[model samples]
Target chain A: MKRILATLLACVLLLSCMSFAAAEDKKTLTVWIPQYQFSKAEDAISDQDFWDGVFDPFEVENNCEVKVEIVGWGIYGDTFFTSLVNEDGPDLVYVTDNYDLVKRDLLLGLDPYLTQEQKDNVILWNTAPENANGEKVIVPMDDGVAIGYVNKALLKEAGLDELPVEWDAFIEACKTIQEKTGKRAFLQNWGATSGTSALMLAFWPYYFQAGGKMLNDQGEIDINNEAGLKTVEFLKSLLDAGIFTEDIVTESESVDKFAAGEVAYIVADLNKGNSAFTPAGIDWEYVFSLKGPAGYGARTATDSFAVNKKTVARGNDELAVKALMYITSGAVMDEFHSKIFYLPPFTKDASFVKDEALYALTSAHSEDVYVVEEFSAKKSFEDTLLANIQEMFQGNLEPQEVLTETMDYYNTQLKEN
Target chain B: MQKTFFSRRRRQALIGGAYILPSFVLMFIFNVSPIFLSIFYSFTKYDMTAAPVWVGLDNYIKLSQNKYLGNVLTNTVQYVLITVPIQTILSLLIAAFIAGSLKNRYGSFLRSVIFIPVIASLIASAAVWDTMYKPDGGLINQFINLFGAPSVNFLGKKPTALPSVAAVSIWKSTGYYMVIYYAGIMNVSTEVQEAAIVDGASPIQRFWYITLPILKPITYMIVTLGIIGSFQVFDLVYKMTGGGPGRATLTVAYMIYSYAFQDKRMGYACALAVGLLVVILLIHLIQTLFFKERDAK
Candidate 1:
């Protein structure tokens, strides 16, 4: 009986050790999501709760662990690269992947890891991620069109019942708002806080609406054409008139006053504005479709998911691809649509959008969505242009001089490249 | 016995070297090596991701073509000149005042209070000052409004933005330099002060002719460090104006950072950094020479 008991105990110990080893072999996946993902005040679902609810089944099914870290947006870009270089980079990084990151060879191409079914789920965008070698490495997960937001109560107080559809009338309404309320009229960001946000959110749409594009077929800047000049002059006039508040100079300073009912309107999408103002109980509405001489053009940004090269280098590419696939899956995207008010999900079956107001803004300005090549050259080009634009706004340089300097600077860059 | 004596001295020297070996190793690893490595990086296009590509003198040559280079340098030099003197003199004055009474409870309390800003984080101070400097609903503007004056856009207008940003730097640094000056003032030979007093010298006369001359070495250190700090000013400017309202406050340090990190022109940024280092080193050498000549006199 003693001999039998000893043999049984040894067998049990071997089984337990094997089980522990199997558990240890399970791969861990890390996803870097911005802290802002939880979105203003937890009035909506917290990012952790939403992801936990969405990902629990996946983790259980695969017997793998998922670690989600909420990185702040300001430091997100730096973290994205540094973490990769250090070899502990997340399996997946959630960012608005600037074409620059693609050019830098920091991300792995998804083509190899993605299955036919997964590729079928990909959304068609005006521009897809193409790395330096023109390989599609990242895919768009969500899209948002930049429209206008208005504090309706303030507008009503200014004796304007309708939002202005034309730029001239917009200026007139701004003057009226200032005259009545003794508050700044519109709050347009004139500074390059995010280097290109003011351009993307405010000025780029105007330039597009006026029938201007940054580049032509040969990849040369047709930037300072007639429409571009008109766009600049229009902004210059608005600046000279002092429609935007002095607070526009700082990057982090938002149009909080607009939401607080101190300013009339701001050039931000309804979804973007609502995330902040809704928590504060600010009654805001989307008022957009900025019509110019040519037509309406919208500011569109893609929130994308890119797999890290390090993940593939470590032979975890399949797992990383699966994680991205799970994120952009119909069910997860559908939930995100409702919670975050992102544009209709990319997956065809997950075309879920929550807010009727978002649909209204999207339908109103979605067709006019503008695209730009934000690759390696874009940062330097936009930086030079925006600095000169700031100079023009401050009365240090004329709009003509601003146009000349900006054109010359980027053209030189083009030649050099 | 002579051989034994030499052997004992050699052993003592080895023991001393062993005691300091770790510190010497650490100093080289942390400080000396990075300086040399950075010099090498200055000549190569390194984006931290890929292997560095050697570009000879191309990066340095690009500096001559930078259109805003002169303007940025002007902003940097103006900042250093304006902030260093004011910071140094003000700190010395405060140090002189607080040094005499450091023994009492109130005096110690004052020292702690003055040093609080020095101890606080630069980024945090910049953020707090951002709120304080706002034109609307800001502390400074609120106070200015009490006088029934029009609100000033301290950070918005070109004329005031640089000075406004500089004021924040000065406020953040004054306490730090004050502590340094106070330490030096504490070390002032009491015998000299007593002799001056005995010779019927007034307080002002003693401070000017006796105490001032004696504190020259500490003053040199404070000024040199202050100049370097002013040149390297970035956090406040980055958080506050971001070199704007139209490049009103774009310092050389901030530009270097932007080029390196934001633009990813690593070699060009390193070249700019090397240029800045050279300029500061030249100033340091000249200042050291002048101080040595004065001391020799």
Candidate 2:
């Protein structure tokens, strides 16, 4: 009887060791991000400090080994897709809004892993990812707003007391600034070719304010309408006024010109207020949306994080779910905002930013913030529009001609796709 | 004995073949194989991630309909036409000057100076040029201002952007071609030049009649190299302009990159690549037909 007991005990111990080994094997996770996103000023190859501070803490807390890999931003999307299709990608990936994950069907749906209560805890309205079928795909980190950053000193030199809140007034202010300062009042980083996204960022506010929609609910291009024509005319008027620099067609970094005080007002992301404008030490302030005839506001794109479904099926679903939770949590979201100086998407009861100039402008334009869901489609219509706009910018085609051509192209693409 | 001799010859042939077997296999695997595979891909509709679907000659048909192709083709032709002649002529001139006038030590030092740009990284040089082309405080504008001329936007204006980029290409490659010409000039018999001088020919006349005629082979080589190099231009344009201010500088190479990588239209990019290869092959065949070496005495 004693011999039998000893054999049973040994068997139990062996089973326990096997189970422990299996558990340990499940703990490893791989993460990938663009090399430039990490602070690697000295070494260039590795950001040991960032890894030790930001990533290592999480790894220890979660009892996992986090392998951080650097990827080039230009090729990241293509590389990520290739890796995913081959089923050899990292468990987590860092991507920008350019990915349009939902429409592409490239990312995993996290809904199956989370409980209803957990899903509810996630700020769905702000962070929810919409698939091509309008299904939620991932949770967003933040919603960005594109606003006009005006150099107050430059404006004052042009005899402007405050930022203009109307189209005509804005144009007049630009003319005045140009006349007085002998500098370009308005500048954008496109030289002869209309960069679709950059043009959209600059001109979409006017379109929205004019009660124009790029695409209707039926997926028809609406830019050939009267409102859209007016938007084009407005852009042409700015160009004709000599308010734009001569090389506006080819200028890659118009923001640098704004930073150098060569332009009074520039259309840029709100995050630039800290990282770009502030670092340059320019006395700049944000301006509210200029009122158009339709009384609508501006629209901006967003970026989100997504999971790989195949990874979940590989038995690390629990860890992946936990990682999603950690990244999208209020604390982590706030940290991202602080690091990037971007507007946080999640709702937190923190004190309002006390920068009087920024607060006043942000509050005034808060109602005008529109989220564009153009990325929710499998194929982007933006490319076609950009090509047409480029022709217009190059003076090869008239603005109206561009609009008509772009509308037709977009319609064809939608119909076929 | 006759039977044994035939067997030995066969054995020798087999051994010779075996010696080159690995290289032949590698070449077929890496170079020849990929070209055929790419041709197959060109006849398909591939999105890189997904399996390719056969579409007959759809990619070629689609290429004809593509509006951007016209601009890309125009840009590529302009680049080749402008850069090749300029680089070849400038290098030949510089080589002639160095070979004729300069003493040995100074000539080598000057040649080394030109070769420095040839050895320098293209991407790094392009980046420096990008900064120098900046409208605000770039060195180019500063120099332009010194000339009592209005600062012209070099890369910003559509009409000038391509030419501006071409200038950088010429600057980078002229030195390489110069080295080739210098070597060619060295090989030319000094006796012929002395005879030309004795015949009451001026320095320029001697160079035009005697030196140039003799340097035909080098000229042909330079022209061919320039044509091939210009067609494959990517790194400089990518770093400097990104094929923009609306595809002003977009070449077939850049377009292929955009299609295969950015747009994920792998089949289309492969079709473009195949088209480029065919064009290059035709040019090379033409060059070979015209530039064959004369029978040596």
Candidate 3:
């Protein structure tokens, strides 16, 4: 009886060890994405549910577990960097630009793993800087072009038949809307804090329209020219005329007011137009961009997926690239952009948008939209520029002083870097 | 016998050290090490991605030449002046009033009610205050509209932004210091108060002569904590104004955050942090000396 019991115990131990080894063999690919609004995912219970459903098929096909952690945009950059420095970062991440990662040698080059079919399957923005060996480190995901959103109902109430396409006309339209309706005609959030490149939406398009150049022939940031001064002066004129109130410095969300039909016009990105107006069923239309001396120029933004170099060290680089490609694949991007109403930059020959006006506005401006290239001093430059512009609106600084001080600061940062 | 007793004491000391080892290790790693590391990094140009390069006095020189530094320092000092005295005086008065006059269930209830804001998180408090400070149809604007007043943007204007943020700090912290003062007041001897009263001292006179003197040490401690806390103000400014409407609400702590996190200029931020520490230490030293001189007199 004792011998039989010993044999049974040994058999049980062997089975338990086998199960433990099998569990250890399984690998988890971690991914971090910011919480983006899914305006049309009413059937999806939560963000996790939507993401898990999207990744479920990929996970099944690879027979590997995909760990997706949805992070808040406020702390996403800090979290990623902190984890990266600790050498325990996620295998894949959604980042707007990966220049810092590439410069630090913390990004895996996807050139080797990308098949020719995969390369031809989607459009590549190549916004992120090439690696030391001139390899692509980012896969483009979505593109956001700066555009003006106007409340059609409010415009109609103010007796405007068509939206303005020029700087002076836009100002006149704002005045007429505010004078007739007694509602806020225009407001933009200038108080977007750290981690947000808010000036791109609120100030860059206007600056570009005014014939400003972000970089000169010397390839240095040179926005201290006549156009830069004019842009600030014009914005200050709006504030002076009561078209834009002094409250814009703290107006962190113009979309909420726009969606509620309290504001007639706001300069924002493409995604915001659908995210706010469609869900609320507000009557709104998009203006590609207002025209100034430089003609139409809208700032375009492309956020992409990047594989961490640590994935290579862990021997999971191929799998990480595969997952990145799969997520950015044309069919998947079409489905994803349909839910969030974002402009999918990678996907081609797929149309999920049914709204004629939205489709026309985005497609018509695709060829002319410009993207501000990545620079070492971009964040500091934007931050100081926003403050100087705010100071101009507050009447503390002249438009000339605003441009001088901001440009000087930007130049100093460039020199130091 | 003396040698045996010394050995016994040494054994006891070893046992005590063993008991505290885990906590000491953690504290050293998290707190003590970072402070020394910051001091070292203050002299280097580190962005956390690449290894730190020695920059000597470069960061400090740039900080001195920085046009915004003067304004940021002035704003921090302004915040400290606005919050410290107001919160200290308000807390002391409320504590004295409750402990002296309304020393009953109602007093306890009031104490609890006053401390509610203290327990609330700073982020939540700032969010609620932001809503109240909004110009269009916000609670404060709606209230003032009934009296035929125009809407005032509290956070949008440079003149009102720092003061508005400071007001939130005062509201949230007055109760905390009030609790401390109340405890200190409760510890005051009844005999001393009785003696003063019997000696023809009025209520105010007794409080002035007896309770106030007894609470002097607590006052000094509270003032020190208040100065340190107000000087390092970040969360309120971060949540409320973002050091904006053009550097009107820029504090040193917020500047450090902007440099370290937003700009990724970690070494520059560390230098700024070290400068702030020296200023704080000097202020603490002055306060300590002043209190000591007064006590000696």
Best by DockQ: 3
Tell me the TM-score for chain B of model 3: 0.96
Q: In candidate 1, what are the lDDT values of residues B61-141, reduced to their tens digit?
A: 777787788999999999998899999999999888887655678878887888898889988998898889778788999
Arrange candidates, best lDDT first. Answer: 3, 1, 2
TM-score computed on alpha carbons, candidate 3: 0.95
On lDDT, the stronger of 1 and 2 is 1
Total clashing pairs for each candidate: 0, 7, 0
List per-prediction Cα lDDT, in the order shown. Answer: 0.77, 0.72, 0.82
| Candidate 1 Cα outliers beyond 4 Å, as residue runs | A1-20, A38-45, A48-53, A131-134, A220-222, A245-254, A276-283, A340-343, A411-416, B1-3
Candidate 2 per-residue lDDT over residues A12-36, each given as its tens digit: 9999999889777647766665553
TM-score (0 to 1) for chain A, all models? Answer: 0.85, 0.81, 0.91
- After superposition, the stretches of candidate 3 with alpha carbons farther than 4 Å from their true spots are A1-16, A38-42, A194-197, A272-275, A278-281, A349-351, A413-415
For each candidate, the DockQ is: 0.44, 0.25, 0.61
**What does candidate 2's lDDT look like per residue over B1-297, in tens digits?**
999999999999999999999999999999899999899999998765558899999889877777667878889989999999999999999999999898489999999999888899998999888888877678999988898888777886688889989999999999999989988888889898888878899998988888888889789889998999999998877777767655678788977876676556678789999999999999899778776643231
TM-score-superior candidate, 1 or 2: 1
Clashing pairs in 1: none
Highest TM-score among the candidates is held by which one? 3
DockQ of 3: 0.61
If both were scored by lDDT, which would come out higher, candidate 2 or candidate 3? Answer: 3
